[model samples]
Target: MRVRVLRVLDVGGLPRVFWWVWVSTLVARTGAFVAPFLSYYLTRSLGHSAAFAGFVAALNAGGAAVSAVVGGVLADRVGRRGTLLGALVASAVTLVALGSVHSVGLIAVLAFLAGLANNATRPATGAIIADIVPSGDRGRAYALNYWAINLGFAVAMLSAGAVASHGYSLLFMGDAIANVGCAVVVFFTVPETRPTSVGVAGAGHAGQPERAGTLVDVLRDRIFLGFLGAVLVGAVIYSQAQTVQPIMMGQDGLGPGAYGAVAALNGILIGVLQLPMTSWMRRYTHGSVLAASSFLMGAGFAVPLLISAVGHPMGVYAGSVVVWTIAEIGSTPPQMALGADLAPAHLRGRYQGMSTLAWSVAGIVGPLVGGWALTAIGASAVLWASLLLGAAGVPAWVMLDRRSRTRVATLRAAEAHWEPVLSAIASPEVVSAGVPTSEPEPEPV
Candidate 1:
């Protein structure tokens, strides 16, 4: 057992994999930190409104949504490492352009472009991991992957806040620097995942036949589609908190330091606890674990609604954050693993890209909805809306549970159908090699 464990890690040493993923995430997410207080920066610093913040955020989301599919298709065709490198370089160039621009319209366009590049990194990086790691180890791989992303963003966020306190120019400078660093590391260190067509054909595995399907055929698979719907709703609610929570907590009297502290807590929790959570939850079906955790994540978002004290809501928010953080640790790895499972040998890049798109859709809607809720009703209304959306997510999760079961059954049936042919071939090879082929005498009927 120990030997098997050592062998798997040796196949891709955790440290080596960790460094590549960590640096990539740090660079990509650091650019993301450029937008840390963007809504506030735009409104308070550049003289905009809550409405303008939503518009800019929505524009970014739209860019991400479109790019998700485009990125996936490109990753499938171009290779994951190249796609990632391209996005990073593009992001860096665009951020430099953004720093030079003064017009809101141009900034909006630049923000969308930056968002396109930023969101594209997700699927490309994810597909690379899928290519390198064994199926059984994917859960831990993704856990570590998520940790890298969050930790990088956590540090970037703190730095961005500090930089912005000095000036927007400094923030942009920092963001651009990080993105350049990201591109450089990825260019030098990360190897391209072997092209799908060549690798699958070379292996001549039976699973190769199923890899012939295009993106449409893969997306149309009923079981996979159902899981996508569940994730879409959960993502929408979960993403809103990124913008909405800051506004609500700011109203509750927390300053930048408090906000940074909470964000750090989130990062620290995932970094420290994610591996243990993956190890402990390995026995559960991916769908069951993801759905349950989604429910918990939604519930955690709802918890802040009960706080009335502007002075004390930070504590309430922190405790609730811990709950959701735990849920995040549980749900994220299984969610990523199941997504990779949905594609066969050839379509891993596209499917993973589509998953990023699914999240992008949420990213687009989440903040806009929060802004609308706060404008029409109040800040508290946003929390209530989150509760409703979260409740709706439960049934979608139930559907995911059913769909996951069906997918497993289908894979089993396919395997069982092919086993006899495989056994016959194996038996012949054994006999040809002068080995006992496990022949059994026929009994009288």
Candidate 2:
């Protein structure tokens, strides 16, 4: 096991700049103090209703949806490093500003702005990894980056729970500091990774004249759009972890501390198991993995209802957490890798941004729906309904997997030019994305 783990990490020979960027990601996520607990703060400490918190959270998501497009454009145009650094600084400033406001109306607006700033860096971040890491290593590179995110999240949840008692302001202030730290690291260490395809749209590969792509062109892609639909559903299920899950626990009389501990299990499990399981996860098809994730998440969130029926303690919500954590481990790395596969080299940021858009959009829809359902139908019914949504999403993904593989095959059949991104997809065990239409070949230097 140890040897396998070592090979995965060492084979990448991930550059020093990559580690610096990874460290920055860990720092930023570790300081993401307020997001996980925001709904809780609104509902419990501020004496707001679940529905109102959902509205506020939705507003935040709305801002993130807006940022997703702008950030992607900026990353490809100006450069990844600059866009990322700017976003980090803005995120920090917004967080500090958010800490001082007391009026609910003002709070909602600031939350929106914070979401914008906080999420804007995502496309740039993904672009940087692709720009830096070799094709064969990008999958494991993404996995390692994910591990950092969860590791940071584990520490944040633990610390956030402890300090939560002293006043949410402290949490906000700490988060701001962390954002500043992330920005500083980026400015100093992470370099610009925007492809040379900056000016001319779809001209050629990375080293040639810089190309640009319109958001319209990217949106027109039927295959990517279909995948986005699946991602949107998965993102909704995923979003429940922070917003609805805690709201449900609060409904059941569990406090921040207990919810914190239970939630920590998610980050903890991913941090520990994601790397070790990456090799195993590579053995499956993308559609199968995504479909399985959707089902597991639906069932996981509904576990509380089953446990309750069996007279189990509601506190054992850990059962639900475990199932979904497994799903998360299975889905995230491949989901990212596959997006890279589907995109043309020039439109990488916009493509990635659209993926972020799905999550941001899910954030908007999931909370409002989850909140309304919790109020009207009750938490159990709302959760169990997730299973139905998952069931609906499964077939679409299966068909999508087939169609996408076919698309790649068609692209390869022609004397089409190969992009570095596509090369990675053709590697042994084919871990990255874009299923190989023919036998694997060594990527050209």
Candidate 3:
């Protein structure tokens, strides 16, 4: 049992840089009190209506979506280390400024700026992980990062309620302080890892020069576009937990306490199980894992329909939460690793940014759609709708996985075809330099 526990905690092969990144991520997320309580602060403390608070929230999400793409471009252009430092520092300033503001307009503006800065860091961080960690270990690295995030969130959620009771200013100040600390950590520890280009003419096909492409270039990649679509669908399906589930439960006679308990259970399960499950899932292809996760999430959400037949058994709801939480644990790390794997060395930041964009877009669209569906067709239909969406996404992800495999195979074939020509070009220079000719090393399997 002790050995098994040790195995789960083992993160030995990943780079030292990743551990520091994980630490900073944990610190930042743990102190994230402002965003969670932003709606409450507007509605209760500032005496704004819930509708206004929601509008401000929507602005934040929209800013995040735009900033993610912009940040990705900046990370590739300026450097990951600098971009991350800028994002953290900007977020800290915004958070501090947000506390001092009383006008709803100013508060909303600061919230959007804060969201932009905070979300901008995500793609840069992801790109850095891909830059530093070996391809084979990326899944584990991302899993460990995800685990840290959930752990921080668990801590933050617990402390947020207590902090809110004190004042919204304290929450904003605390969050700002944490962001500053994260910035300091990155400034000191994380170095720039962006690949340097040798120039288009000098570098051959195998060693193509790294260059930042326009957003149109990213949009043109059909495989990536398909993957993004699948991700957007999955996010919308999973999002029902936040927007629709509680309402349904409340309508069925469940209290806030019951809903909070289930939500907490989801967080706890992911925090505890994500790393171990990620390690175990390394043996499977991304497609299989994603398909299974999508189906599980859909099935879990669909279980609410069974509640009507079961005479409103709470056990059915609880069981569904468990299933979906497990699915969450299974899906995140593999999906991130796959994104990194599919990205070119130069385009990693952009690819990750695009992936983040899918989630951000879903954050905006999902609640609106789910809320509308809930009112228009009722809860049961909404749940079934979520299930159908998940089912549709499974095939898209499966196709993405197949495309990724095909691309890897094509690259390998190209490398094999170019080997002899490269050797022929180099042989005369080698002879002139008095170096003995030998077989070239084989490419990584």
For all candidates in order, the CA lDDT equals 0.69, 0.74, 0.78
| TM-score (C-alpha, index-matched) for candidate 3 | 0.89
lDDT of candidate model 1 versus the reference = 0.69
Give me the candidate number with maximum TM-score.
3
Candidate 2: give the clashing pairs: 196-210, 197-210, 197-211, 198-210, 198-211, 200-211, 200-212, 201-212
| 10 residues in a row with least lDDT, candidate 1 | 436-445
Residue 38, model 1: lDDT of: 64
Candidate 3 residue 125 C-alpha distance from true site, Å: 0.4
| Candidate 1 per-residue lDDT over residues 320-350, each given as its tens digit | 7887888788877788888875655356667
Taking the candidates one at a time, how many backbone clashes does each contain? 0, 8, 0
User: Model 3, range 362-435, lDDT digits (tens) per residue?
Assistant: 88899999999899889888988878877776887787888889765553343343434333322334223322
Error of 2 at 336 (Å): 1.5
Better of 2 and 3 by lDDT: 3
Q: Which stretches of candidate 1 lie over 4 Å from their true place?
A: 1-19, 40-53, 165-167, 194-198, 202-213, 250-260, 308-312, 374-395, 405-445
